[model samples]
Target chain A: MGHVIRTRTRASTVAAIVGAIVVLGLALLPLVAGRGLIQDMFFILTMLVLAQFWNLLAGYGGLVSIGQQAFVGLGAYAMFAGVILAGIDPVWAIPLGGLAAVIVAVPTAFFAFRLAGAYFAIATWVIAEVVRLSVAQWKTLGGGTGTSLPRTATRDIAGTGWIEAALDVRGAAARDILAYWLALGLALLAIGAIYGLLRSRRGLALASIRDNEEAARSVGVDAARLKWSVFLAAAFGTGIAGGLIFMQIARISPDAAFSVTEWTAFVIFIVVIGGIGTIEGPILGVLVFFALQKLLADFGAWYLIALGVIGIAVMLFAPRGLWGLISHRTGLELFPIRRRLITTKGNDHG
Target chain B: MSILSLAGVSKSYGSLKVTDDVTFDLPEGQALGIIGPNGAGKSTLFNLITGNVLPDAGRIAFDGRDVTRTPPMRRCLAGIGRSFQIPQPFDRLTVFENLLVAATHGRGQGEAAVVRDCADILERCELSARANDPAGGLSLLGRKRLELARAMATRPRLLLLDEIAGGLTEGECTALIRTIRDVHAQGVTIIWIEHVLHALNSVVERLLVLDFGRVIGIGEPGEIMASQEVREIYLGIEI
Candidate 1:
């Protein structure tokens, strides 16, 4: 039989074309956008990166980790240690931060694996707190008091001089632009990687496991192996995002780096509101989150309360999130991970 | 040649014995029917064979290889596929995708084989029209067919069907029986656990009956059904 497996629909085919153009447009946006806008984009892109990783873990892998902030903090602190103690350039230190998170994640994954569901979420949060406490004792990176990147390191960061000359801007503007480009690039890589995994057999396996673990196992799915791989991969991506986040600010401390509200809560909110499993959801989720923040930031306490109210409303009215609702109405999947069966019955299975 | 043998297989939940030294042999490519009242442990036997539950004692050999310690998936990969009493389709996945998982992971087939196998199995089960529908949205009959279709996609040598006829309309049951007969005709072994006597009677030549986890009778279906002991214990016929 001549049969084909497909994920793309007619809408997704068109979306792919438009999406590529949008990416190209986004790349060129830095050329014309002002400094503040680039900075804002940096925040949104990094949050999207973190949200996508979370989506992969909880949305597809069936892992609901509440302590992803642990990786974020670990990554940020690692960047500080690399720059301050190891005398590494701030730019190169970003990858070091991610490496640090991976090192910590290996041991944490084993511990977290023991618990499941709600317990797993709690265990991750507790471990994150422990990580933050452990890092707090290290005086070399300013200990409990926290510290900033040295002036010399910040003044001559990797790609800073080149970006300044190329973009024809001030030193501060060059720094922002450099961070902006890096954020854009990493966000694209994150989305691409998630899409790639979801398209492969691995994605099918994860989907199987998430639907029903026992049923998945009965069908020869190595549920444990698939889950562990997803957990670790998400941790690595989150670590990279975390490092980038703090590197943009050029400051780090256990409390600031590991703040649950800043790193984990906001990321969870984005994924939850956007649509947990699909690649398009987080993009929409982040924009909505930013829009809400901008409108409500002046309200302070009202802003936080309003977020809670809206989150509840969404959960009740549309449990699948905004993207899920949109997909149901429009049937447009930008990153199609679902397989379609194309059958040529004339060629029978002999 | 015997394709499977369960010798002195036993299992218990606390003090309740679900399977007490249950033993049987199934010949290659022969369709066998198992009948029992509620709680007679027909499902437990299926679990033992499929590796969903480990037998407390004795050996389970498949094609002359001891597989007592093999995990459930390995048992499936080793050519033992089964359907749940209640259909367990991967609900979020499309019916086609559900079959694709079996053809790929369970059968270890490549892309071309998977695509062909899934399509063939879907058509065989009369699910070609509903292939694009999400499994969760399928009607009961469709879900049941999807279950059988998914099991067949694994290309199993021995298929264990647990109550495949339960909750089906007479027409649906007849359709399923026809499909099961066709599967049997292809020389694939079948071990069906069902309460629906007529459905079982249509497909299997050999019938095995259980009561309280012990074999009550085993023979040709007509011989066993007409026996005095079966009439007294199972049929409870006064005439």
Candidate 2:
């Protein structure tokens, strides 16, 4: 007889199967769905990617940063710079944006790491503002007014022609299909990478750091190093999502690129209302967010007020978020990371 | 050879000296008990040794290497493990997960490599029943056991326990002492800060007494307890 430690649950295995089928179905949607639905999905998928990255930083790493707009703005701006200035295709330029975001995140973390709690959150916002202002001074990218990706660049993006030919769609519809597929891929990568990270040894260290930094250090977990890594990773993922979003919109202005309300606030709200710490939280949160927007967008300020009310109510009643409430009741984990010890007889694998 | 040595160590917060020119040495594999009145810098001494707090002026050598400026994490990795005076378990983590964190990082091993050892540590600490529960929901005794279990999981050559025996029932204290004895018998050096005199006496080979941030006496357990200064300061008995 022996004991085996495993992190998998029956529910997780089933969830994995269901998730794969759902992703496959969504991947095939662009083949049959109208352009309007495709564009809507592109929006949801990109936002989901952004929300997951934010959740990893704030929810898992215990970093509540409101300055994620810095990465989004920098990434989008960098992509624009690559296409407009350097003649790189917008698709290839997206990775350049991610790289640029990582480059900026190092210094941002160096400064923001000095602050704690709410101070840290505010410092990240301030840094984002500074980045936004500095990017606005670059006249080549239209400075404060911003610039559009040249029609030539978007019309002939690397995979747009391939998608157009394969899906039997016009060039405009092909571009939308291309962007939608890219958004879907990015969402999958973001969630997959974060899920992998949260199950590794570093994930355990991160959880400990989130619980108590001093105790974590006493236990030999290097909280500072882990935090730096998480911050940079979030910045990289956010930057790519930003680049992808701007590629779809084909426009870039500092204000539009770095809008805290659109990028940071909405992402935070999704993670908070969906569930902050769990992977399932942001996935569920983005859907709720999209539904609320579709239902209430015509009400203008009332929409914002409704969101605020719902946010406050969730924080008060279900503090862990909606998914948290559900998971607490059902004991189901789609992406389970908690290890359980099971006793097994000899030659019987667990 | 001494496993730990503190020479002329002093720490002051503002004008008040918390550790005033203290010096001590403990040979390898010896269990040394520390007793002191409130505010006598007992926990402060443990902090200084564990690298949680740096001294104003002194050298601290562990295993013949100077570690005065090493950070707490590095010190833990260097085989100096400690339990907090207050139980500080990672509240959201399960008890077994808590041990996994300590074992993996403290030993610089991967989870797959340390999971078995973590389970053994859990069973030895008698926390097997609560292994899957969140540490925050644990009772006081369970938390204390977790504190001890976590430090032990670090695979330390030296363990520093701070008032871990306090706030437990007599039976609980006896059971804890038995666990400590089992650990001590395995030859891990121990520096225990305990107010439970009988518990301290039963395990420690030597006793050191502190009063007002100064070492009042150090000797065998019986000799230190018999000393007039120790009796007056620690026992509060008229000499």
Candidate 3:
């Protein structure tokens, strides 16, 4: 007889199989969907990518940072520099954006790690402000006024021609589809990577740190090192998303690129309202957010007011968020990371 | 041979001294129980040895190496595992996950390499039924068992138990003592900080009495419990 350790559940297994089918459908959507629908899906996918990374940091890693815009802004700016200055294709420049975010994150983490709780959160915001201010001083990227990608770069971006010929769409529409596909790929990568990480040994260390830092340390979890790695990793993902976003928009400004409201606040809202720690939360959250935005787009300030009201209501009623409330009642885990022990009657020999 | 030694370790918070020049040596595989009143700095002493709180003075050596300034994680990796006076399970993580964290990180081994050992510990600690349950939802005894199981999962050479039996019922306490005794019988060194005198005496071969951050007595359990100074200070009985 032996005890067997299992991490996957029937529900999660079903969810995985279904998830692949859904992804296949989503990947094929642009073939028949209108430009408006494609653009909307792109928005939702990119936002989902951002929300997932934020969830990893605050939800799992116990790092609440409001300065994620630093990475977004730096990534967008780096893409701009690569395209306008280095003459690199906009597609090739996306990874450069991620690199820039990592470089900035090293120093940012050095200072922010010194603070805890609310102080840590505020320190991150202040660092973002500093990064924004510093980037505002770069005259070649049009200083505070900002600049757009060169027409040549956008028209000849990698993979757009094949997309155009294959789909029989115009260049602008092809670009939109290309960006949409990249966003889809990125969203998949972010969710897959985060899910895999949470199921690994490091994820256990992270959970322990989140639960009790002192006990986690006593158990030999190198909290500081793990946090540093998470921060840098999140920054890298966010930077690439930032670059992808700006490449799609073909424009960048310090204010727009570093907009806390756009990059950080909305992301936090998505994770908070969806569910903070669970991987499924952000996916659920981004969809709700998209629907709300579409329904309330005309109301202006009241739209924001509505979002605020909903966020507060969820926080009060379902502190774990909407998905948390659902999962609590149903006991359904779409991304089950917990391991189970089963006593099996068998020989000890392997 | 002594597995751990502290020499003149002192710690102060502002104007108040918590640990005053405490020094001791524990031979390998011995279970030494510490009995002290509230605010006696017994927990702080454990912290100093575990590297949670660095001493303002003196040195700590574990396994023949000076660990006076080593961080808590490093010391844990060096085979020093401890339980908090208050159970500190990863609230959202399952009880089994808690042990997995300790086993993987403390022993510097992969999860695949340690799962069977962790499961064995879970059964030994009588937590196999609640293995998949979230640690936060556990009862007092369950949490206590988790604290013990987590420490054991680390495969530690030196196990430090801090007030692990403080709030348990008599039957529960006995069961826990049996678990602790089993751990000791395996040749692991243990330094337990406990106020439950009878339970402490049943397991530990030696007893150390602490008062106002000072060690007032250290000897065989019978002699230390019977000493006038220990009775006056720890038992609060007038001489």
* lDDT of the candidates, in the order given: 0.88, 0.92, 0.92
Off by over 4 Å in 2: A347-350, B235-239
Report the number of the highest-DockQ candidate. Answer: 3
Candidate 3 TM-score to native: 0.98
- Assign candidate 3 its CAPRI class: high
Calculate the i-RMS of every candidate, to one decimal place.
1.5, 1.6, 1.2
Report, to 2 decimal places, the DockQ of model 1: 0.63
Which regions of candidate 3 deviate over 4 angstroms?
A: A348-350, B235-239
What's the TM-score of chain B for every model shown?
0.97, 0.97, 0.97
Q: How far is candidate 2 from the true structure (C-alpha RMSD, Å)?
A: 1.6
Candidate 3 clashing pairs, residues 3+ apart or interchain = none
lDDT of 1 by residue, B1-239 (tens): 88999999988999988888878899999999998778988999999999989988989999999999899989889999999998998998999989888878897766566787688889899999988888999988998898899889889999999999999999999999988899999999999998888889889989998877888888899998888777766765332
lDDT of 2 at B232: 72
lDDT of 1 by residue, A115-208 (tens): 8999999999999999999999999888998999898888988898998888789888888888888999999999998889878777887888
lDDT by residue for model 2 over B1-239, one digit each (tens)?
A: 99999999999999999998889999999999999888999999999999989999999999999999999999999999999989999998899999999999999998777867787878888998998888999998999999999999999999999999999999999989999999999999999999888888899999988887888898898988787787777556422
lDDT of 2: 0.92
| TM-score, first chain, each model | 0.97, 0.98, 0.98
Point out the worst 10-residue segment of candidate 2 chain B by lDDT: B230-239
